[model samples]
Each structure stands twice: as structure tokens, then as C-alpha cells.
Target chain A: MILIGEDLNVMSGEISRVIKEREPGPIQQCVAAQTKNGMDYLDVNVGPVKKDPEGTMEWLINTVQEVTDLPLCLDTTNPLAMEAGLKFCKSKALLNSASGATESMETMLPLAAKYSADVVLSVINDAGLPSDADERAASIMESAAVANELGIANENIWVDPVLLPIGVDQRQVTSYLEFIQMLQDLLPGAKSTCGLSNLSYGAPKELKSLLNRTFLVMIGRYGQHSAIVSGFDRELIRLIRGEVPEMVELIYRAMDEENMDISALPQKELEYVKTVQVLMGKSLYSHSWLEV
Target chain B: MMKYEPPLEKISVNIRETVVGHGEKALKIGGENTLPFHFFEGSLPNPPGLALEILDTEPENWAPSVLEPFEDVVSDPVKWAKKCVEVFGAEMLCLRLLSADPMGKNGSAEEAAEITKIVADAVDVPLIVWGTDMEEKDAQVLTQVARACSGKNLLLAPLVKGNYEEIAKAAMEHGHAIVAQASMDANLTKELNIALCKFFPPEKIVIDPTASALGYGLEYTFSIIEEIKQFGLADKDKMMQMPILCDFGGDCWRTKEAKENREQGILWEAITGITFILAGANLLILRHPEALKLIKEMVV
Candidate 1:
């Protein structure tokens, strides 16, 4: 239940004013609220920030860093912004991406490896958005492979299978679920989360809230350790906050109930090995006994 | 302008022995070279058919137009099916058991069996018995209904994660077809088809991509069905290739358009039929004869 505050730049109507004002209290209050609400990390995004190109992000990044001593996501659409913010960041922050795309491999990955930072790679690439789960898995495997190639350890790479809005395409819900499942299977130990409220954007009035909550509960079961939910719902937050002891129960209740046999998943790809003649087989082995 | 190549194209599928009625044509759900109703290329040996939707009990919430045609026969299952076949000229009957709804009066297995037998004997038209969409109770209800209509070539739906075992056993013993229903998911549809293939043959399986009306989320439904069709044909997935039958006439009639009668019932119904036709439906359950007439003309 570790929350990460999302601060996308294009959103927050008063972002430009914040840049001009450099007001610490409001941003500090923003940080304090999420921290009180159990946020372990406060994500600072200069997202889609191509409009006022100059030192706007540097100011926001420096100001947010001053306000919150907690770790930051250092999120940005602009690679330069990502670099500048990460450079100024105080802690071992989480990098937002380095994808299966060749350009991404050349750029964002090396920084992740060099900094020893956790990376959140989207399950997307130059292959484009996969309309189905199998294709989404392909892109994720590609991203993971690239991360491996960069010598970034497996524990540090998180795969986000791009949560699409169900309002845009209702059929995408299943694809989203399957993609999440694939990520859980593929990355056995990595953070998985999505913006929760996006499912109800344009659905019918009666269905919007109901579907959004239903989607939350379902995705929650699929190994989503983190989520971006409505910050305004204080009662539910208090409800989630009060029952910390019941957290494992509520989350793992069904897993305990069903023992969640994951036999639906295919067998994992076998590792290539060449044995030695002393082993009675010509299997030459390199790292066959995985060094933990 | 859009010249294309379809790899793993579904060659053809044949869902055999779905008897529509005594005199009516065999509902052979199959085509070799295209998706449903691409008549220009594929040899569609059996033209798609329509079924009149009847209920064993009065539905608590139904579109007024749908209930208007069968208000008189709602009390009796035999009378209901008869009225659908005789007065409505329905080539087949889609007997939706509103009684099996968990929230409803909840008809017993014996009562469901008696009703099925009555409907089977009253009108020789083939029956498509659907449960109340409740997993547990539907498994109980359809088990009896399938047995009652045994050897008569009835089609029972939707054995999902909860109820597939019982439905498969009954459908196998009763010589009935199983409808693989997926709720607005192409991947789940593929998996459900896979589950169906475990016990049932391709010819005995009919797929339901769970169609909805055009404006009311039909586009999403259509995309899912199209993906399933593509998987069936292009992937040559023997299980996924089960011919799809969309219950859109049921889907459309229950929506606002059918309920909005301002002397525009025919126009509204025509819009539904045409929309579903374009969206890839192999079978339909419609009430309005005029709507069916318009759809038939468009298909021709």
C-alpha cells in the first residue's frame, strides 16, 4: 500500500503559476498530505512539458526537491528534462523509463545502470501499442531484454503495460488485465501500478463509478502493489489507513481462498546451457547455478 | 486501396446440426474464406437465421417494444413458443429463462424441465435455452433444460469458469450444442473457446462474443468479435474458429431505441439490424417482423 504521488505537469491548472510563484507551502502541503496518506515516494513529473521549454522544469524540480526529502520519480516526457531533474535529485530516485525502443535503449538506460536507480519501463516500443496481451508481452520481454543487455539488474526494472482509458475503448480492459497478468508472470518481483480513475472517463453516469471501483478490485488482485487513486476520497483512505493489519488479509484473501493456481501460464523459456564432459553430457554451462 | 494479406487466416468452420425447426433450413454456421457475412468471397452455405426471444416468466425489466409482441404468452412457456413461431413467423426460438434469475422467483429444476418439454412439444422449432446469466443457478437450471430437450438438438449457452463442468456433461448427454459466451473480451472469448474444445467438438460449439447495440457500447463489442473472428480464421485456431452468433436483436431491442416509440419504431429497429449486420453477427434474436424484413433485404 505504498503510495507514489503523481504530479504530471500538463495537469494541475496552476502549474505555470507554481513555476512563477515558486511557492513551497502548497507543494510542501501536497507532499505532506501524500506522506501522511502513506506515500513512500513523491513522483515529480514535468510531463508533456514542451511548451515553455527553458528553465521552467529546473525550477519545479529544484523547488519540489527542496520541499520533500522523500524520493522522487523524476518523471518527464522530455529526455533533457529527465536528465536535468535527475542530475539535481538528492536521493537514489526512480527513473520513469527506458523502453524496448532502440532510441530509449541508447538514451535513458545507461543513466539507470550508472545511477543504480530503479527504472519503470513501459511495455511499449517502436512496435507500437499492442492491441492484445500476447503482443504486449512481446514488447515487455523486449524491454526486459534491453535492460538486461545494459547490465541493469533484474530487480531494478519495473514494466508498466500502459494503462489505456476504457472510455476510449472498452475492449481494452481485458487487454489491460492480460497485460498486467503477463507483467506479473514475467517480472515476478517488481512494482506494478496504473492510474485508477481512467476507466470511467466517458462511460455512462451509472456505470462510471461502479466500473472504476470494480476495475480497482480486479487489478488489485493481479499483483498491483501500488496505485494512483482519487486523493479526495478521504473516508476510503482512512479506511485503507486504519486497517493496516488487515492489508495482507484483504489482498491475499482470494489467493488464500483459491490458492490461485497459475497453471494457465505457459512454461518459462529454458535457459541455454552447454554441459562439461565430466557431467556425462556435453553441456557447457555458464551461470547454470544462478548466483544469488 | 487497402490491399492486405491475412496470415493464419481462418479457412472455414462448420457448426452442424443446429436444427432451426421442422420445415426451416438447417442452421449450418460456417464459411471458408471470410468473416461472417463476407458473401462476396466466402461460400456461406447456410444463410444466417433469426430467433424470436421468449421467456418462461415475465421479465421484470424489458424494453416495452420487446414485451409488446409477446405480452399475452408470458404466463405459459408452450403458448409463448407457439405464439413466437406461429404469429411471429420466428424461424427459431431463443427461450431466455427469466425464472432462473437468482433475483427472480427462482424456478426449480423440475419446473424448468417441464417448461422446456412443453415448449419443445408445442412448437417443433429448435430451442436455444439460455440461463438467467447467474453462474450457480444457471448451472442448475440449464442442466435440467438440456436434459428435457435431449436429442432434440437444442443449444444451451455459456458454460464459464463456474458452470462449464455441469453444462458440458448435460450438453453431451442431451446431444445439445454449447454456446461459448465471452463478456466483451476477445482474449476471454479465445480462452472460453479453448475450454469448450476440451470436451466438445468444433461442430457442436457456437460462440457468443456478447453483442450490444451500436451506440450503447456496440463498437467495443464489435471489435472483440472481429478479433475473435480474426483469431479463428487467421490464426487457424481450431477452437477459436467456432462460428460466432451475436444476440444483438436481443441486445438492440433492450436498449433505448427500441423503447423510444414516437412513431419511429420501424426506423429505430432498422438502425439496430443494420448496425449489428455490419458488426459481424451470424445469428440474431429479434421481435419486430418489420425489422427482420429490413435486415433480410439488406443481407440479400
Candidate 2:
């Protein structure tokens, strides 16, 4: 898995303070940590920089570039900020997102083409988030067509099916998995990524890590290309990097519904089995599913 | 005249840059994000490394032409290694422990390690310690070599499915890189790499999908190499992202056509080397110095 470091996002208290105060120390430290932790890219998310968007993005890009050379994912709603960040990037940058919504497609796709940068196409439209896998595919294809017409190659368009919290709607989790399974056929040559932590948003802090790691393995089994992931998650990184093949294999076997005695599994393996069942909607979503 | 624009997609990840040996003379291979020699589209930070092959014992069946260049030093592995690096201008040397073959001399692991130490100490360039394909013997000999040459950062070859665990563990414990050899099948190559990466770091692993000689399954080897590169760069499969190594000199020299004439032998090796280079080989091991010179001049 190609890990885009999510630790530098403006949503975090320290990261937001560093971006707002223009402090290079914290940003560079974060970059070093991510680089050492084996991140392929680092996300520079200055959320919707409403005030001095251009200046904030330019400062953030320059500060981060000073420390590491890993490509930055320019993540923000503001197109002006996105362009500013793209201009200063020493390497190819990923435009965090555009959607099927006209305003987003019109503003973001052209910048992606002009700059020759990869752009993430979120599967949402003016009607808002898609209700099912088919709806999500329609949104991605419509936006991808616009991107292709504007000269962005299909390979550069990373489609995000918009992972929602399983606790809120268990069926949508299945829809996202179905969409990923259909991604290669639906939009040939395009890549896929997701904000992985979004799937655990409503879960308890103690359970978020398990949720994120389990879903990552599930999506990876379906050929999800990459994911925005926490840089500090060593076990998660290990699992994705093929360091823990037995664990990944167990998850795959569970996903395949291979005949196995659940009683024979160890405690950790049983948790994974249960997590896979919940994610696959074989069992009901509950806060205590692992306990059950 | 028509203006032509090249169609290119920016590769997201580079094949990891791996440094072998130590110091200023250390060799760096891989790190190119684009396909081999596609300089118009992407950067090739390091050119492919070239290593000349040397045998731990007197070579038994080497053709006359291949042996002519190193006739004086053939009996002495250390002297032969020095000749390749100092005289032929080889940037790297691969010491093949053929003496350790169970059917051959069946050289002891301690003896193999002693010889490896002498050659590794003699050559300033990076050294690769290769073993006979007998997995049990290779595991024993290579582990000893890895221990004796600790911190030399030597590249070990032919870590196939049968003995990858023992050898890879020793390589990691001793701080060395490994060449994970698979048959001429892309899926097997990937499976071996994935298995190796479970314990070893991916940066220290190189893929050898088993090169075949020209006119003898060369196309199969070529297709497999191309497929591995495409899966690595286009599909971005991490398991297939290691630099590829093609040790085709032995296969090439053993061919009937190569033995027919000296010039044909040189051309045979040169053609095989360059073919794999074009198909995305990051490290090549060739026997004839002239063929190495010809390939370097042609591709570099």
C-alpha cells in the first residue's frame, strides 16, 4: 500500500497550530517522522484556508519541502490554496479532491490538468453522497470524464468511494467494498485511495485502530490502490508492507469464507475474524462485535 | 513534419535505491521511476550496475573464448576477482561458490567463507556471493559467508523458495542484501518476494526471475522481465518493485551456438545482457570482459 501520511493534517491541534502560526519546527518534525515511518507521500491538509489561503499553503509547502522530498498531497477545499501548493511542490503533487459536483469539477480538474498533477475524484455529486455502489460509480465516472477531457489521464485520477463510518450505516461499508471491486472495470486505468480513518470516525478511541487496520486489509484484498493513513501506526504499516503475512493471510481467508474452525483461532486472530464478518456485513455492526 | 508528444504517466513510486558494499566505491542500483532507458519521461538517478562473474574453484566447462580473458587468474578466485575489477574496469564482482555443489567438490562452508573473505577483501568494488542452486548447500555456505563478511554489505544471490528463510535471516542479521531468485514465472517471482519481505526489508531484496540464454527461452525470460517491470511501475505492486538481476552469462556461454566460435560467444553474451537490460535489469552478471565492455558501451 502507498501510504499518504495523515499526521500533518490541519484537523489535528498541533498541525493546525503549526500551519496557522507558520512554525517550521513542528511541520518538519512531522515530515521527518513520516518519512522515517515509511510514508510514500505526506498530506498537507490546511483545511479550507478561508483566510490568506494562498499564503498559508505556500508557507506550508515551502516549510515541508525544506525537510523532506516525499510528494505532498495538497488537501483543501479552496482551489486557490490548492494551486498555490501545487506551484511550490518540488515533485508531483496529488490534488486532494474534486467531485462530480459542477463547482468542484470546474475549478479543480483544470488546475490538475494545467499542473499535470494527479487529482483525487471523490464519489459525491450535487445530490450529495451516493446511496449505493452504482451511484458512487456514476459520480466517479462523470467526474473522471471531465478530468480526461481536460487532459488528465485516467491513471492520474484517483477515485475515492468515500468511506463512511460502519457504525452509522453497515450497508454503505459493503457498498464501498463493491465499488472498489468494480473500480478497475468501471474506470479502467484509474487508481483508488480512501481516507481510511473515516471508517472509524464514530467508533471509540480504543477501537479506532482495529477498525482502520481491518478495513485497510479488507480494501487491500479488493485491490484498493492506496490510502490516507496514520503515520504512527507501526502495526498497520507492517501489515500493509507485507511484514505480517500470516495476519494478512488470515484476513484473506476470512474474506474468502474458507472453511475453518473459529474455535481453534487465537484471541488476536479471532478478533480479526469477527472484524471481517462485521465489515462484510455477515454479522450486525455493534460496538461490542469483537467481544461477541 | 508532425510534432510528436510522448504519452507518459508519472510513476508514483520509485524502485527503492539500494546501496551495496560501503564507502565511495559502493554501488547504487534501482531508484528509477520510469521504465528502463525512458529518460524522456523520468529520472534514472543511478545507472544499472555491471558485475563480472568469478568462480570459487577452477571452472570446469567454461568455453575457451570466455576463459581466455581470465586464463592467468582462473585458478585463484581472489586474483581473478581483482583482475575483473582492476583490469576489466568492472564496478562489481560476483563470486560463484560452485565448489560447494553437493555433486562437485562439496567444499565445506568454512572453506567457502574463507575464500569469500579473501575475494571480498581483495576487491574495492561491491562483491556478490552466489551459491550453487542446491538449496541445502547454499543455505549452509551462504549463511557462513554472510557471517564471515559481516558489514561488507555483500549481495547474496539465489535465495529461492527452498532456502530463503535461513539465508534471508542471516543476510538481515549480518547487514547484507539478497537476490531472491525465482523461475521464469512472474507470479512465482512476486510470491518469493512477498515471502521474503515477511522477514527481510524490501530495500535489501533484488529480484532474479531466472534469465535464459538467447535462442533458448530468451523470449520467455524477456516477457517475464517486462511483466515484472510493468507490474511494478504501472500497477505499483510493491512486491514487484525490487531491482531485477539477470545472471545470464553462464546460460549464454553453455549454448551450442556460443561454443561454435569465439565472436559468436561474445555476441551471444552481449545480446543476452543487453536484452535483459532493455527489459529492465538493474544488475547484470556476465563472464566475458569483452561482452561486458560491449554492453556498457552500448547501453550506458
Candidate 3:
């Protein structure tokens, strides 16, 4: 999987402070550490740190290039800031991101074409996040059509199904997995990504790690090619280090604590789910493995 | 309809270009930006090379098919090495120190070094000095050969998990390249490379993922080579970025099919060599002269 390092983003208070202070030490350190941890690309998001988002983005790109040569994922809400980073990048950057939103398409597509950069286009427009899988697939296809017309090659596109916080709407989890599978059918060669941490927004720290790693592996079977994630997260790292585990112990733990339903799993996997249910004395409660 | 372009991986890690036998005799390999022969997508900077195999001592119990070709020079290492390059048009020559095996002649390290030096001096092309499959004897023999041909830059072999540190140190202390070997496991191949890189540079290493014959796990060998290439091209895995050397001829000639029929023997070797080439092997160490000729013609 192509892993984009997410630690450099200004989402954290410490990183925001470092960017605000114009300290190259922390940012460069983060880039080195993440690259060592096996990040294919580093996501650089100078999020609202200063009046000049473009200048700050440029500084971030330049500072990062000084330390290492790994490709940068130029991330920003502002298209101009993204372009500013792209313009200064020594190598091609993965543009993160565009959406079905007209303004995003109008700005990001031209930059992607002009720079010959790969782009991440989310499957959400002014119509807002799709409530179902088909709606999400349609939004992604529409955005891809625009990108295709703009001459951005299909291989250079990453389609994100816009993962929602499961805590807010539990139903979005099923839709997210389904949409990832639908992405390949809709946009043949286009890659798919997920910001894995979004799945556990309201969950506790340990539970959040479990949720993100398990969900990443599940979506992987559905054609998700990459994930924007913390490489240092042991659970996420463990998955990338080798093939997915035959069974994730976290699933049994979640059922034990949160009483989460796992019937969404296919037949073969459901057998294990049923075993866990029986072992936990939950549904179709039966004798434990130790009993007989 | 738009042409369905496969997503060619943007290779981030470069396979270090290695030059063997410095100056006029130097042959370059690696530095490919794409999978082997996917010239439409990216460049294959160098053509896969062929190293004709020659043994240091005569074969008393050799396969009749292979033994027939070198029947005249079977007794002499220097003459056998010369016949490969001067007569057969071999791009490189590999001198296998078979007599150094503890179970065989139990030849001293000094004797192996002497013959290696003789082969090195005789060949205008580069030389690959391979050790016996025996571990402890290989360490002793290869250490002597590395020191004897110190600056000749001969490609030494059989750097397994057991003798890696010893031979790796010798290759580094002397100026020779080492072939890191593993048995059909891509991860183990990378692990050996990574481990060797701690002492010897990655550029100075060639991966030998233990070649398999045509009827004997060739598909498994193909997948391992493809995985090594994909990791380099797709994930830019630095440890997997080195050129691969498949010693398929050794395994191909030893199969029961080869022992039964001479025609089947040549076909087995040819198909195994071609399969590995397509699967991204940069060097093929071959036995049959006809298979070598066929591959040279096919690849060009």
C-alpha cells in the first residue's frame, strides 16, 4: 500500500505551534522520522497557520525537500496553497485533494494537468456526503469524468469515498466499505485512499487504533490501494509489515466491550464471528471452548 | 475508447548501477526504472547479461549432456574459462569451486584462490567466483579468493545467513562484489540484502533467490523475481532494488528430465532462463551452450 505520512499536517496543536513559530526543526524531524518508518509520500498541510497560506506552504515544501527527497503529498483546503507547494516541489507531488465541488474541480484539475501530478478527488460535492454507496460511486465517477476531460490520466487519480465519523452515523461504515469496492468498477485504473483515523473520531485512543487498523484491512479487500495514516501506529504498521492477520483479535475485544455487530462479514469470516459470539455468550449463546 | 494504460509504478528507489571488472573490461547492470522489458512504460538501462558456467576441476560423474560440450577442457580451469569467452561468446564467466567442497576434494583455500586468480587473469570479461554449497568451506574458500583477486572485482557467491557476516566483511575489506543468496523467498532475499548492506554497500550486492528448474518450481521462482521487481518499481523498496542473478542452469541441468533426455535437458534450461528474464533477472548463469546461444539470440 502507498502510505502518505499524516503526522506533518497542522491538525495537531504541537505541529500547529511549530508551523506558527516557523521552526524547521520539528517539521524536518517529522519528515525524517516518518520516511524512516516507511512512508512512500509525506502529506504537507500548512493549515491556516498564517495570513499567507501560499508562502507557508512553499516554506513547508522547501523545508521538507532540504531534508529528504521522498515525494510530498501537497495537502491544503485552499487550491492556491496546494499549487504554491506543487510549483516549488522538486519532484511530482500527489495533490490532496479535490472534490465534486465546482471550485475544487475548477482549481485543482488544471494544476494537476499543468504539473503532471497525481490527484486525490473526494466523492462529495455541493450535494454533500452521499448517504448510500451508489450515490457515493456516482459522485466519484462524475469527478473522474471532469478529471479525465482535463487530461489527468486515470492512473494519476486517487478516488476517496469521503469516510464519515462512524460515531456520528454508524450506517456510514457499511457505505464506506461498499463505495471502495465500487470505485474500481466506476473508475478502472484510479487508485483509492482513506484517511483511516476518521473512522474512530469519538472513540478512545486504544479503540481508535483498533478501529482504524481493522477498517483499513477490511477496505483493502474492497480495492482500497492506499491510506493516509500514521506510520508509527503499530497496528497500522503491523498490517503493512506483512499480509493481514487471519483473524484480528480486536474484533472479539470490540464485541466484548462495545457490543458491536459483525454480521456484515461474509460467510467464512462470519463463522469466526459466530464463534466469538458463542465464546462471549452473546448471540445464540453456547458453551465455552473450555466447557467441552 | 481511451487506450487502457496500466498504472506503471513510479519507482522511487533506484537500483544502484554496478560496474564489474573496472575500466575497459567493465560491464554495467541494474539502473532499470521499470519491470524487465516493459520498454514502453520505462527504461531497461542495460540488457540482461549471460555468464557461461565453468568448473575449477574436471567432472568425473557429470551429466553426459553438459560434460560433452567441455569434454576437451574438462581437466583445466584456465582453458575451460577461455573457451567460454574466446570461443562460445560468453559475456562473462563463472568459475564454480566445486573441488573446494568438504565432501569432495576438500581442496585448501589456497588452491581455490590460485585457480580463481588464474581464471581472473585469463578472462577479458568479468568473472564470478562461486563457492561450494557447503557453508564453512565456502567462507574459508571465498575469503581466500576475495583477497587473492582483491581489486579484480570478481562477483563472489553463496553469502547465506550463516556465512554472510564473514564473507560480507571480506568483500568490503577487499574490493569485490558478493552475491547474496536465499531459497525462493523474496522477503529472505531482501533481508539478506539489508543485512549485507550494513557491512557492504547495496550497490556491491547481487541477489540470487536460489534458482529453480523449469519443471521444478519455476513458477515459484517467477513470482519471487516479480515480487522483487514490483517492490523495487512499485514500493521503491531499497533492499529489493539490486539486480537479480538467477543460477537456474545449475538446477535445470540437475533435474531428472535432463538426466533422462538430452533434448529435454536443453529445453528445460532455455525455458527456465527465458522465464526468469521476463520475470526481471538481470543476470542468468547458464550451463548448456545451446541454451546460452538461444537466450542470447532471443533477448537481443
Name the best candidate (by lDDT): 2
Clashes (N, CA, C under 3 Å) per candidate: 10, 0, 0
Model 3 stretches with alpha carbons more than 4 Å out = A1-292, B1-12
lDDT of 1 by residue, B137-173 (tens): 8899889988877787787876786788888889888
- Distance (Å) between predicted and true CA of A220, model 2? 22
Candidate 3: residue B119 lDDT (0-100) = 82
State the lDDT at B296 in candidate 2.
91
lDDT of 3 by residue, B11-64 (tens): 555667776675586788888888877788778788888888999988766679
Q: TM-score of every model?
A: 0.55, 0.53, 0.53
Give the residue spans of candidate 2 off by over 4 A: A1-292, B1-6
lDDT tens digits, residues A1-292, model 2? 7899999887889888877887799889989999999999998888889999878878888899888989989899999999999999999999999989999999999999999999999999999999999999888888888888999988999998999888777779999999999999988889999999888887768888888998999899888999999999998898899998999999999999999899999999998998898798765555656654
A178 Cα displacement, candidate 3 (Å): 12
- Share of real interface contacts recovered by each model? 0.00, 0.00, 0.00
DockQ of prediction 2: 0.01
Please list all clashing residue pairs in model 2, or write none if there are none: none
Ranking of all predicted structures according to lDDT, beginning with the best and ending with the worst: 2, 3, 1
For model 1, what is the error of residue A155's alpha carbon versus the real structure, in angstroms, after optimal superposition?
22
Name the 10 consecutive residues with the lowest summed lDDT in model 1 chain A: A269-278
Q: Per-residue lDDT tens digits of candidate 3, residues A1-292?
A: 7888888878878888877778999888998999888888888876644468777877778888998899988878777687788889998889989889998899888999999999998988988888988999878888899999999978999888877665444457777766776776788899988787786676546546655666665566567888899857865777655644655554435344545455665654554455433222232111121111
- DockQ for each candidate? 0.04, 0.01, 0.01
Order of quality (TM-score): 1, 2, 3
User: Model 2, A240: alpha-carbon shift in Å?
Assistant: 30
